[model samples]
Target: MKIVRSKEFLGARAWDAQLIAAMQDATVRLHWTDQPYPWHVNDGQEVFAVLDGEVAMHYREHGRELVAHLGAGDIFYAAEGDAHSAHPLGQARILVIERAGSV
Candidate 1:
């Protein structure tokens, strides 16, 4: 398996929002590691899979951090209007899927 570190904070703050593309279509894949970001709910649906390590996903509507400790083969999905953030709890690799033109 390929391992990717979270480079989201490389040239910005820990809270800076960054999105790394994986697969873009009706389903879009984005990867992130070593950082936390804030996001707002848009028009498309999204799915998150932890390719490696652990991450804490916070959703605005939930009002709590969904500390998703994902490893290989783990997955999570968030629907439309689900405002959230992707945060690396450790050295993490996450796969995010969303619709095109939604971000």
Candidate 2:
């Protein structure tokens, strides 16, 4: 058994992640970041959940740009082929579940 304290987790660099589990073709990760992630489309679906702090989720739909503010306990789902990026308001911890090897 493994126990993780989300509030106590930190990384050496921004966006560094702790691997929580690898289930078949998917992976569950805990990420800590104070910087924004670059925009990209994943090859499969993605589930992003905020565990601490806040984030500004920027996404594109219908060729338009949009953003959604996410706080603790909030979740953001990204379907395959959806272009998106994450910008933390300051520092944040997020739980991400996605297909293995996807980017």
Candidate 3:
């Protein structure tokens, strides 16, 4: 059994993550970041959940750019080949689940 105090988690660099678990072909990770992640499409589906703070989720749809404001407890789902990026308002902790070894 494992216990993680999400609020107590921190990383040395932006987007640094703590591996929470490896479930079959997917990986659950706790990430701490104050910076924006570059826009990219995942090889598989991705689930992004905000654990604390706020984030502005930027995504491209039909070649148009859009943004979704997200706060704590909000969840964002990205299907395969969906291009998106995340920009934290200040500092935020997020839980992400995606295929193992995905970028």
Candidate 4:
């Protein structure tokens, strides 16, 4: 994983791409944007907290769509092994945390 040497210049609503490698511990990511994110899945469970704007968590299954929106200080969990999608609901900032499980 890329070591975050510092938290400098981490500003408002924007989309940034980060790749974490060989991380077996919990990690946190901050997102500030109002753009649609592509469908994807991660290797672990994730928690998202909307600290500023709004974010909608989307899931597609069996030809149906499910949606949930989170506002300021709202929190949600992303299931492991599920194809999930997310996008900012408004101009917003979010905190994402991923936990590491036993090997």
lDDT digits (tens) for residues 27-93 of candidate 4: 6666656687788776778877777767788876667888887788789877676677777765666
lDDT tens digits, residues 1-103, model 2?
A: 8999999999999999999999999999999999999999999999999999999999999999999999999999999999999999999999999999997
How should the candidates be ordered by TM-score, best one leading? 2, 3, 4, 1
User: By TM-score, is 3 or 4 better?
Assistant: 3
Candidate 4 Cα outliers beyond 4 Å, as residue runs:
1-13, 17-24, 61-63, 99-103
Worst 10 residues of 4 by lDDT: 4-13
| Model 1 agreement with the true structure over 1-103: per-residue lDDT tens digits | 4444553333333332245554546644445456766667757787777766677676655575455555666786778877777667766656666786677
Instruction: Give the alpha-carbon lDDT of every model.
Output: 0.62, 0.98, 0.97, 0.66
lDDT of 4: 0.66
Order of quality (lDDT): 2, 3, 4, 1
Between candidates 1 and 3, the lDDT winner: 3
Per-residue lDDT of 4 in model 4? 46
Q: What global local distance difference test value does model 2 have?
A: 0.98
Model 3: per-residue Cα lDDT over 17-90, one tens digit each: 99999999999999999999998999999999999999999999998999999999999999999999999999
**TM-scores for all predictions:** 0.62, 0.98, 0.98, 0.68
Q: Which candidate wins on TM-score? A: 2
The alpha-carbon lDDT assigned to residue 58 of candidate 2 equals 100
